[model samples]
Target: MAISIFGLLEVMLLFINAVAILNEERFLAKIGWGRQAANPYEQESVKARIVNLITAVSTLMRIPLIGLNIIVILYLVVLG
Candidate 1:
């Protein structure tokens, strides 16, 4: 059914988003902007703060997205 197809598509897109987020984190770390390298002086920079904020928001969003993906997969399996 169309609903089932759409659910599958959503799952694929969510998976891609998760991968992209991971890649973003990796890229940030490679560029010396990772969360682990935080220091008092590093926090003073507007650019560093902005990057940290964006990373935090993306990571938070990813949690709910992963849960939604699981729920969608269950729904598709049970009702598709």
Candidate 2:
């Protein structure tokens, strides 16, 4: 039962991660493929900063999620 619950949580996290990645790509497209603008100020605008932060956070989330997923898979294969 606990394993099943954890598996469900993992799936939810994976979905959230996918959505975050999609949003990041969308934001980057809106901002010109993450290119730096000619105007320095434009390069550091609020939208740009928010996108950067989101990228960083989503990247960080990926590492742990991948690790957790591997652990869960191994657990199921070895003991399920």
Candidate 3:
């Protein structure tokens, strides 16, 4: 019973790590795309504000996700 539980925990950890890596890659891609898109919007004031606002909001939402991820990793490492 104990061994099965540990096996499950290890699987969960692998899944979480994969998800974190994918999210990081997607985020970096989005930032790169945003940077490339800036030049085209240089003459547009309203569009720039909207784009910046969206980016800011998305970044804010990621804070809790990152924190939770860290906590989960610590829990798995120390207790599992």
Candidate 4:
């Protein structure tokens, strides 16, 4: 029972790690795309603001996911 549970835990950890890695990659890609996007209205400050805006929103959204992931990891460890 415990061994199966550990396997499940490993899978979950891999999933979360993949999600985190994907998110980071997506974040970088978005930043690069945004930088290259044509926009006459985008001044230096506006570009900075847009970058920060995207990052802030993404970070805020990811906070709960990360917290839940941590909780699950802890739960699995304690379950052992």
Instruction: Show pairs that collide, candidate 4.
Output: none
Arranged by TM-score with the best first, the candidates are 2, 1, 4, 3
Cα lDDT for residue 34, candidate 3: 49
Pairs of colliding residues, candidate 2 = none
**Ranking by lDDT, best first?**
1, 2, 4, 3
Candidate 1 steric clashes: 0
* Candidate 1 Cα RMSD (Å): 5.9
Candidate 1 off by > 4 Å: 1-16, 23-25, 29-57
Number of backbone-clashing residue pairs for each candidate, in the order shown: 0, 0, 0, 0
Which structure among the candidates has the greatest lDDT? 1
Model 3 has an lDDT value of: 0.57
Displacement of residue 37 (Cα, Å) in model 2 is 14
**lDDT per model, in order?**
0.69, 0.65, 0.57, 0.59
TM-score of each: 0.40, 0.43, 0.30, 0.32
Best by TM-score: 2
lDDT of 4 by residue, 1-78 (tens): 366775777686666555444443456556563434535576566655665555555556466667767887797789
In the range 1-80, model 1's lDDT, one tens digit per residue, is 35666766787767656544765455877876666656668677876785677576676777777777698779779988
lDDT of 2 by residue, 1-80 (tens): 35667777878877766745655345766766453432456757776675566666576777786777788789879988
lDDT of 2 at 69: 71
Candidate 1: which pairs clash? none
Better of 1 and 3 by lDDT: 1
C-alpha displacement of 58 in model 3, angstroms?
4.6
